[model samples]
Target: MAKLIVSKFGGTSMGDAECMLRSSEVAFGRGASLVVVSATSGTTNDLIALGKASESQPWAEAEKILSKIHSRHVKIAADLHLPTESMQRLETLFEEMGSIAKGINLLKDCSVKAMDTLMSLGERMSSVLCTEAMAQVLKRHNSDKKAMWFDVREVLRTDDSFGKARPLTKEVESLSQKKLGFLRDYKTVVVTQGYIGSTEEGMTTTLGRGGSDYSAAILAEGVAADVLEIWTDVAGIATTDPRICPAAKPIDEISFKEASELATFGAKVLHPATLLPAIRKNIPVFVGSSFDADAKGTWIRKEVEDHPLIRAMAMRKKQILVTLSTPEMLHAHGFLFQIFKIFNDHKVSIDAITTSEISVSVTLDDSTLVNKKLIADLSEIADVQVEENLTLISLIGNNINHTPGLAKQIFETISDINVRMICLGASKHNFCFLVSEDQSTQAIQRLHKKFVEA
Candidate 1:
């Protein structure tokens, strides 16, 4: 068995022709490797827009957008020195994508089915192009130019859940081994698509937000890869979002548990759910800067020690805080239960929540589908208000069961800020607070200063 590494190249790595070439160089530079690639920068978003626009109004504009997309990819292929045959093939794929977009426009309502089919074009095109480019580079180096680009739609099986498809884990796990075994038949590299999988019925599906990272993790876990490198635009995982805290430094390593906490809260580096499959397989994931691949990156392991009480931070902005107040909830069995049932039925997840003697407040993503039926039921005895224009900032660390008056210190640090509400997690390692959107950056900087920096 050959040692394998699955490098999950982010959008920045495959952003354009130059980025794609540089990534090809890094592949051989970093040693024996397989690669998973996301779409070129902004491709997925463009596809999503095309879908929405087509749904509302399928117009001639779809053709204009399609032409624009085709020109970009064709230009990139030309710049990359891809063989004429490969360039033509890449163009054909884009044409197919364009066709789908136009179909959505004509349909005047892009179904989840159509959206999944459309969104996948981003990764599919990138991998195909990157594979061709890598093949040319390897040929120049006297290395084998026989890399096979596997379409994930053929193997990555999942449910028919439309946009957010859940994989048939056991099925995929078995298939992964089989596929890798077949892929290893060639001594060259294997380039695969990220962020897109297929349903049992052979329809395209996505793993929700950050699906590309999740795709990488699943592939790594499936192959038992020695390393799963997540190459992005940044150096690595930072102590805090530098955009919010300029002093934030890159972390060299993090435990899976810690990484999970940070990702879930707001690290914004890895998809929060991306770590689960990796953790289950005890796979080590590396987060590194694509622009500077030589730098020491962050490593995530299954079990770890020596984490800071305030290791890293994150935030979910533009959240809605819902407060339900009623005397009926106090000492009334199943009152709060019914409220949650409503939320559960609607599929809106609660991030942080607090309960009082007569009221229950929860922070959610403000999905439009929150059921009116549940609201009507709650209205029978409770008052409800949806508070928008708020942000929830959280600090995730390890063994924070007690933080030496951390609550008091946090309040004192950002006391002048507009503090709307706060909730410390039961584990005590994480403390979350609500504040005005305008003060979010300042509040984060303040907490970063007094607590983290000297």
Candidate 2:
């Protein structure tokens, strides 16, 4: 309703009690921060792991599993001396999570729909903790503390699609305006979570991986927030994976389009879908470090200076390449229709696709959950091969297009490494290639040294 500042902190940003304190400090450092947080360290995985393990057995076993996870947060609150009301809400959340786990166990099958409902607790629990922590720390340090635990589940609505649900925009906007309807009524801080949402029927849902960042963006857009600060573990988006490209430098600023490209390519710092809402609203999103609040980090915006090509590099290791070779693809019109229809029926998303004479090669994220039954259908028209454990390296930048020797420079650097496949003219500004998972890190290092570093 008002120009609020919505900040989203990742798991690493709120990894512990200390990180939570630092997140609040970062919030206060910038006035009127609306903080959104992921689960406290390892909470999501713990919850999911329990959900999977509990499906085969009695509900009580699953109930105990979740009780352990709940106690960890309880201990942190006890250590911090959280106020009465917040702590009581947390107790209520644990009860809900426990009940949900039992339900999953009774169901015996953890469908994506079921999993989404079970896993919403990650954000729900963390929001309660973060809100309480913010209240205590801000009251103590900033001396002008005003914070509330905001329920995004009440506002960030989505379909009942479970693991990878699309946001229900109209409902979410209306609910957000109503729930956060008050920021215009007053100046305050609100803490919430990323990733999870609820349906109109009150069913719990998750907005895919990195959904929390998207949540932050949507809230910023809804409240007409001045800025969205995304707190993470790294030094903003990098030129390359620092693990591979040691010379990779932090980007001071990048465009939303560029940020989306980076997320698609390999920059795990921001979710691929997070930028659209911010871009639509023309709100600036800042990615900063949770450890050092003063770091300039990176700002994703609408404009950029005369920056160099290849702003960053992103690599993903878990992949499978399905190369379709058939004569029908050579001169066929909309032959792609047949190829896509098979994937669509199976609900598989092709991460990267390239076509040529008599062949179409697709790189799919491993989590698309493909199986041999679907492959049998594809083998009808084309020869199918599944290249497992490959890594995708995407060179990302605005001016990445129409570079004459850029491809040459890249290949020359990795001339010796066995490159599996390469795709250029990748959209407006990316050139991606698939390499052996083993060589991914080395290939990135070599590319950075040759093209990026002095």
Candidate 3:
């Protein structure tokens, strides 16, 4: 039996007609049975802007963005030379978007549900265009079979978390068996949207920003795919962001654990949650550049032959460090518990933590969204200090904590830079710390040179 491969193309890969055509060739050429696509580059952001405008601005303001969305899709269709039927469908979808915007304007409310629905449009439209483009390419290549645009909302079931929903794994598996189980029987390519899923009640919900990668992982596990390929803009996982360090080198392969650490800490190659499903299924995951389809890219799997001491480094910027000091915390048993309870109640996630006898400091992402309220609540118990514009630098590999000289090497490399916080021994794959945002690039370069270049 031919193995079913699930390939996901990121937004940049689907950005324009030319990009979509290139992506189609990859999908068709690779014989990917299932292709999940994100919104064209910038489309999701534009949709989000439209959602915001609809909530507070007049219909005119919303209409401006609506027009942009419509015109963009129309141009893509014209560029793709879509059939008249496909062109009419694109028009209808645009009209529906306009109606949605008008409805939000009339209601003066952009509820989470409404936002989800609005955001889903980008992927919906992209999937349609991608499927049609792939079908046309297959015809051009003399293949009789056509690509099918699949509405994955029907197969991926999730809870009602609205913007950041969680997929019900069993439900997804059951539905995939019923809906997509027959893909093996036919020589057809299935194209579907990423990031968006439906609740059991059929309400639209997104998996969150960068959730498209998560969507692909879930679908890969659900359909028992032999391989899951994540096609994005870069050459794949690198020692450090190439933009940050020109010397950053691509890692040919990495373990699932190391990749997870990189994604969680700061790497943008894959959504943090994308590896969970693949890890469970023990599927071989490939990260490749859609733009450079021939590049070797990176492979992520259960285990790789060689385990380097420090495989890569990732930096997460725009971090906020919150330090809470209370005299009462000294020798108090429940002091730590109290701090954690506040976080749980407010649903604020901490990225890293450190503690002294009377003080505890933690780092958080999306601080702008959670800091003010969290600080207000936390202040009731301790004196709070918030520092913004920090960055978390992480060294990812095997036994990094136990590896001799690694700690000294990292600190020595950045000895000139102020080290705000150091977190170690939490994960075998990572040794992370906090530094000023301004010094992040220097830190990455110095560390990459010491470990990767050396």
Winning model by lDDT: 3
Order of all candidates by lDDT, from best down to worst?
3, 2, 1
lDDT of 3 by residue, 130-193 (tens): 8888987898899866688889999999999898999999999999999999877657899999
**Which parts of model 1 have CA positions greater than 4 angstroms off?**
183-186, 367-381
Give the CA lDDT, 0 to 100, for residue 188 in model 1.
65
lDDT of each: 0.80, 0.80, 0.90
Candidate 2 per-residue lDDT, tens place, 1-454, comes to 5356788899877766677778887887776557888887788888888788778877666767777787888877777677788788888888877776777777788778778876778778778877767877777875654888777888888887888888877777788888887766545678887888888888888888678898888777776777888888886877877776667798898887878888876678888888888888889888888787777799988987746677777898898888899887877788789989998998887888888889899998876534777789889978987788899988877666687778788898899888788887756578889999988888888777766785
Candidate 3 vs. true structure, TM-score: 0.97
Error of 1 at 30 (Å): 2.2
Best by TM-score: 3
**Tens-digit lDDT track of model 1 for 182-224:** 5444476888888889877788899886888998888877776
Off by over 4 Å in 2: 1-3, 58-64, 141-145
**Stretch of 10 with least lDDT, candidate 2:** 365-374
Error of 3 at 105 (Å): 1.3
